[model samples]
Target chain A: MSKNNSRKIKQSVFIILMLTPAIVGFFVFYIYVNFKSVVMAFSFEKGGETFYGLDNFIRFFKEFTLPDTMFKDTILNTLKSFLSTIVIVYPVSLIMCYFIYKKIVGYRFFRCLFYIPAIIMPTVSAVLFKYIISMEGPIDVFLMRFFGRNVPDFLQDGSLAMGTIIFYSVYFSFGGNILYFGGAMNGISQEVIESATLDGCGWVRELISIVIPMIWPTFSTLLLTASVGIFTASGPVLLFTQGGFNTYTISYWIYEQMLENNNLEFASAVGLSCSVIGFPIVMLIKWGLNKIGDKVGA
Target chain B: MKGSKIKRSISQRVVFAVVFVLFCIYAITLIYPYIFAFNAALKESGRVFTRDMVSLAKPARWKNFVDVFGEFVVSDSGYFKMTWNSVWYSFGGTMVKLITVTLSSYVVCKYRFKGRNLIYNTLIFTMVLPIVGSGPAMYKLLSDINFIESPMMIFTFAGGLMDLMLFAYFKSIPWEYAEAAFIDGAGHFKVFYKIMLPQAMPAISVIFIMTVVSCWNDYSAPILYMNEKYPTLASGLYSFHERIRYSHKHPIFFAGALFAILPPLAIFIAFQNSIMDKVFLGGLKG
Candidate 1:
């Protein structure tokens, strides 16, 4: 073969060799697993026999429509978790990041302190938090001493369990948003900020008008990613409540099905149903965000 | 603007003071738990429940750390074995992912090949298209293939966030270097492995540390796939906690929790700057 032909062959070989692992991984782990999930969703297991149909999906839908079903409850809990992240966690994190960006007193210390949770194992944090808020734990003791009232079992009380989980979720997310938004804000031109300040832009106005718009791309990306993870919006459920106390989220319910119940088909049905319902909504949200991003020149 | 040069209005100063106080309170909340854990871990196991948890440990039981090695056993794996498992699991998985991402990203970013765009688009598409609840299917597939409890399960992480980050990293590096290496009689493999790969080391190392930290702390995978035989520190700690939940071995469990966090904590402290800066950049750019 000629030299050019040999190089072409070599290049082709190189590309194939490089791409093989990723391709195999994609096919087996992503494509094959998803395909199996779809197939499993449409199938049911009989006594030592496998039957393919819509039995699992039909059962899922039937249960999902029923009032007070675990399916409906878990879905609602997941939605609540997602919205809490968007409405409460995101804004709180943003405001905190703004103050940190402004070089608030002890900003460096606060920045590192906030990031501690992100680095620590979620299991460890959950375990510690569980004890800290337990009936006779620090919070309880403080409440009793100061308020002359007994503290409720935060994680055990059905009314307070989900709220506690949401609180944990919000606390855990602060470090990450601080890092991301802080970095984004760091990238903002100092000259522009100085100009805003010279224009008499106060803290709130600067955060609303100048800082937010400048970091819009990062904010939007985080928002989009959070939306993409809507179905998986869960705290450390296994460590905290084990899906008890009416705090089950969709992801935990799916995990429970697989790990505890050993019901792969039903789990797949639920998962596929989520994807079917969630995909279009996510797409529309992405489209809407993109449109807004364009308008805002993000 | 210099700190001294920028003048804050009265309202801005007031806002700053309020924000500062709020941050201080939040900081205390963040720090208080770890302090409690430290004090609680040093207390006698029985006293942890009986005594004031807010106070310092009386007659500090430093042996709790040593005792955890003996007490905190999950699936017949002790503390040292679990730590070893954590090391191999995190490093092994991270190396596999890094190699896969680096190799594929270098090839796709540099070489003019058919299906290159297809591969790129596929990576991005799969990333953006969230596939929730495939855990059951994944578990089944792995079990069927007998990959469960096997180290070979690391290959499943071959394509993920690192792929896009490294793809972007490699794209920025000029192909002229590769051409020069080829002209100097270096083969394609030599050009990639010797010339281009070294240049991508900084990006790879950042991702490597991040992935290692994540993998080290990842309990779910080991809990599900490693079976009861091989428990990493995180998974072992988890199961250990469950085992002692009713027994009220709070001190021993807290000691184990503290032990499990040290490695990752050390890593974060060491790479605080790189992690804080690069991770966000990777996310934004990807």
Candidate 2:
């Protein structure tokens, strides 16, 4: 074999070797674990019997358990979280990036400061906020002093708890949106703006006609991502609530039911139900967006 | 003309200055909590609880740092070997991710391989699936196969496939660049290692930093897999916090969390611009 052929063999072998751990782990751990979860979902634990078939799933569907309430809450929280991301986070990010892109002075400092939250670990953020939202924390203390009123327990209150979690979801992801929007803004050429100005277009007109249109593809991508995340968003609730409150999401519910509750079979049934629910909702949203996108293109 | 130009420039400066100031206030609010956590970490136990919540302590308690480090249990003779273990896992896990993702993404995005579209869509769909829904099925599988305890769990089974990050970056690279290398008689590996890898450095760096930071700070996986022997920084923070839950709540726990998060935070500040640039621009151009 020539030197090139030998090099090719070595590289291929190394790449294959590098990939071996992951491939083996995926099959053994992920594929096998899930397959067993399916089996266990049908049967009860502790007896070690095989091929019970559909009983666990039937129990899940039939029983009015805590997991059922949790399932409903999870779906609601997921939808609420998505709406919050879309309505608040995305628009705010676009506007903030617009200001920064226009170099609205001291942009560098502002940009750096806004981006800090993105880099912090989610667990740390949750713990920090735990202190911040405490009765004696600055914000609550101030509220106690200023209005002569007690600051409500943000985490424990069932009605307000979901909203509080959703609020952090937006805050945690806000930095990423700024970065994406800023990049999109930067992609708009100066020449296009100048030409639009020469054509007697106002600043607003230029932005709407040129900037928005130019970044439509990025918008489409973010929209799809935002929608998909609605079905599966996990961070704030996981780190903050630990799915403790009535605010337990589908994901957390599955986790608790499987691991903590030791209803391995029931958890798998719920997991399957979630996948069944989420997959179609996601597909429908995408189909709708694509239809709108195609019409816009047309 | 000069007078009008001067007025326009002045107005522009004023507008920019106002935006800057408003944004500063917003940034400060977001930053204040973390900065307070840092300060809380440095405060002595007494000062942490009794000191005015808003005021800085007179003499900082640096011993909180020592307490966190002391929690790491190395066998008979080894000290800080746990940290070394974490470092190994992070690096090993990231290496696994980089190789699999790069190859998988390359085949899908670049090569006209069979089952390409099916693979791509499935991966993306899986990526978006909620962690809770997947956890039960995944945990049972890992446990049954005796993978729960292994370090390999970090890279392959647990966390994520990271296909989205790799796919977004892979799709962005122009076909022409890869084609040019092929035309020059570069084999696939040669093109990947030398040409494609170099071009995709920004994406690689982003993924590398993210993987390392995530692995370092991860709490759940270590709690699940390592059990007692090797806990990552996040789990360590949780353990430390739980140990001294009452009196040391303010400073010591905050200190541990701060110390746990610092390495990643420092990296973030140092490479902030590059990270942001890669996140948006690198994936959007193509």
Candidate 3:
């Protein structure tokens, strides 16, 4: 071979060697795992007997329909958590990002403060929050002192536990929103904002008309990603409630099935079922968002 | 027009004031938990339940911090061992991930080759397409392959969002530097290591710290795979808390939790600017 051909061969070898590790990892972890999950969803394993078909998926649907099973509650809680992200966390985070972007008083301080949750371990946050809302913790103590009555344990009470978990999830999520939306807002032109100010556009009006539309790509992407994670809308279930007090989301239920009960096939089925159900909904939302983006020229 | 500008400024100030107060209250919520944890960790274990949580720790037993090292044990691994586990796991995982991601990203982004766009498209496709509920499948695969509880688990982090970030970062750097290195008799490997990699170091370092923080705090993987044999601080502390949930060891547990948090907290404080700026940039560019 010529010297140029030799160099070309060398480059090929280099590329192959460089890409090998990541390719291997992607194939094994991402592709193969997903493939196996689909297979496992169809396979049935019980009492040392192994069979293949839709047995596991059938069992999943049956359990899902059963009134006594926690499946219904898990689905409902998951939806609630998903709604909390979209309705509560997303809008609230966008507004907060706007305020910080506008350089509101103490904005720098608040920016640092808000990003704290993104850095800290979820385990640490959950532990701290757990203690804070425990029976005799500060919230409890405050209620007793101020209202002259003791409060129920937030994490233990079935009626309030899911709400508490959702609250924590919402709280922990803002930091990430700030990072993304803050970055997006940074891309907005200062000239436009100044022009809006001269036109007497107030903060709310400016945020609604200018800042949001400018940052709509980021906003819409985050929103769509949250929708994709609808089935997996989870709090720190293991750390906070351990799937107790009717606070189990679909993700946590799947986790519990696999880890605790050793029901891999069942967990796979439930997961695959959720994916099948969630895919179209996500696609619809994506399409809808894209149309809106086109309409607004975002 | 000048009057309107003044009016806008006045309205903005009013809004700013309201936002500032709300932020102060929100800031209190964020800071208060850590403060409470620190105070509670300093209190006597038994007294933690009896006393008002807002009250300062009477006698301020600093011994809980000292005792936590001994008390926060999982299986045979003590707190120090767990800390060591965390250090190695985080560093090892981050290094493996960054090295692979950096290498792959550099090659794919810088060099034009066959299957390059395919690889790039695959990465993007995998990222955008959310495949839900593969945890069980992942666990099974790892167990079957004897990857569970093995040090090799770090390699699994080799390809992820880091790919997109590093890819974007590498793509932006002009190839003229490589051409210069080539003129000076540098080969492909030397060009990357000597010329290109150094230029990419700032972005890599930011990603390194972020990944290290994430890996340090990751309890789920260790909990599922490493189990009791090799418990990192997060997992060991979690298991410790679970073991002693009913016992009067809240202060000691809190102490361990505080200790577990300090490394990442210190890291964030040190690299706050780079992390905030670069990570945001990476997110957008990627």
Candidate 4:
């Protein structure tokens, strides 16, 4: 055989060799485990005899009920929490990137300072926020000194609890997003900015016309990935809210079923349902944005 | 108009400065709690509010770290064993991930093989599935199969498809070098090892550090599987905090958190230059 054919053969074998460890791992752990879970989800535990059917799933959906009280409050709170972060963080991150790209003084210092929270563990961040918002914590302590009024429990107050959690979530993670957006902004050529400047445009005009348009692709990338994740991003809630039966999102509810409640079938069903609902909504929105962005570009 | 340009430049600088300061102040607020945590850890159990503790002039209780290490028995027999366990787990995981991801990415990017998009799409699909979604079922399956407490648990924890990050990095590496290596009569392993892996080292290092930090800081796996007899530092930290919180005698629990966080923080600070280069430059320059 020629050297080229021999090389192809060697490459194929090597590829197989390289792929073995991950393949075995992915199959044995994730795929096999998930398969088992799927099978188990169909079976019910009864006196060590497993009865397999759709009964578990049927029971889950039929029996799952939301009290008017729960449906009324946590639903709104969850929506508010989710929307608030997107509304607040994305725009703020974009603006922050804008300044950094402008090469503002102390840009490096500001960038580093903002990103400090990103490296800290999420649980630690939540606990730190909890302390900060506590009655005796710095904010309240300062407020009490000025207003002579007792500061309420930020975590416990129904009206403010979700907002506060959302605020902390957004604030803590803003630094990382700034890095992402800044990187995207910096990817745009300096020549483009200079030419736009030469066209009798100032910072605001250049920003509005050029930078925003250029970075919209990155915005869509973020949207595609992160928007679907709002349902599943329950780590902070787990750490902070503890259960959020008071402010329970669907993901938290799913967690309770799987871990705390041990309704594996129900949990799987809920998990599946959340993916089903969230994925399409995210895809549609992303698709719509891309179309609009393309048309706007045109 | 020329005068206006001067004023505009001045205002622009002023706006930049103002925004920069406000941003700094905002970040300081985020970090203030950690600073307070540091201060709280420094105070002796009951002497938290003493007159001497009121001022920064009062030296921080550096003994807090000493007390934490004492609790860890970190000086005693086999203290470094657990650290080794964590390192091995992360290393093993990274090796597996690096191998799988590099090959899979090579196939998807370099070759037009069958089932290519299928594999790529499946990998992307896994990104949407939360580990928590499968956690309960996985725990049950592992328990039933007698896999809990086994060293194999490390593999389970690391089996998520991280091909996206790997693939993104691989795509940036021009195909020309690999082709040249192939032309030089190098086998695939030789090419991957000598050429691809070396080129991907910057990203590999970043991702490796990320994995190690994750494994080292992880409390859940050890807490769930290893039982009390085989506690990782995080589990130990949790238990220690429980003891302190319940006893109302803070045994420098803040110091414990500090110790828990310090290794990763130090690693992060040491790599700060590389991190900026890799994170932004990799994305942009690619």
lDDT of 2 at A253: 65
Model 3, span A50-106: residue lDDT tens: 889998888888887887999889889999989989998888888898888766766
Give candidate 2 regions above 4 Å deviation: A1-40, A43-48, A64-70, A258-261, B1-21, B46-52, B71-82, B107-132, B157-191, B243-249
Pick the TM-score winner: 1
Model 1: fraction of the reference interface contacts it also forms: 0.60
Worst 10 residues of 1 chain A by lDDT: A255-264
Cα-based lDDT at residue A219, candidate 2: 73
Index of the highest-DockQ prediction: 1
Per residue, candidate 2 scores C-alpha lDDT tens digits across A1-298 of 6987986676566445534544565555555666666665666654675557677767666663665454566677767877888888887787777777766656777777787777666667777887787667777778878987756888888887888888877776767777877777777877787787777776556666776667766776787776666655655565666676667776566655544637666777776666666666677877877786675561
What DockQ does every candidate get?
0.64, 0.38, 0.61, 0.38
Q: Per DockQ, what order, best first?
A: 1, 3, 4, 2
Provide i-RMS per model in Å: 1.9, 3.7, 2.0, 3.7
> Model 1: clashing residue pairs?
none
Off by over 4 Å in 3: B1-8, B47-54, B159-162
Expressed as tens digits, the lDDT of each residue in B1-286 for candidate 1 is: 3554446779879888998988888888888888899988888775445446666788889999999899888888888888888898899999888887788888888877889888888876775676787888888888888888787767667645227667777877788988887788999888888888888776888888888999998877888788477888888878877866476778888899898999988988888887776655654554
Candidate 3, B40-98: lDDT as tens digits: 88887764454555678888999999998887778899999889888889999999888
What is the C-alpha lDDT profile of model 1 across A1-298, one tens digit per residue? 6988987888898889888877777787788888888888888989989999989888888987887688777888888889998998889999998888877777777888788888788878888888788877898888889997767878888888988998888877787788888888888888887787888777677788778887888888788888888898677787788888999998988877767648888888888889878888788888988897887777
**What's the count of clashing pairs in each model shown?**
0, 5, 0, 0
lDDT of each: 0.81, 0.66, 0.82, 0.65
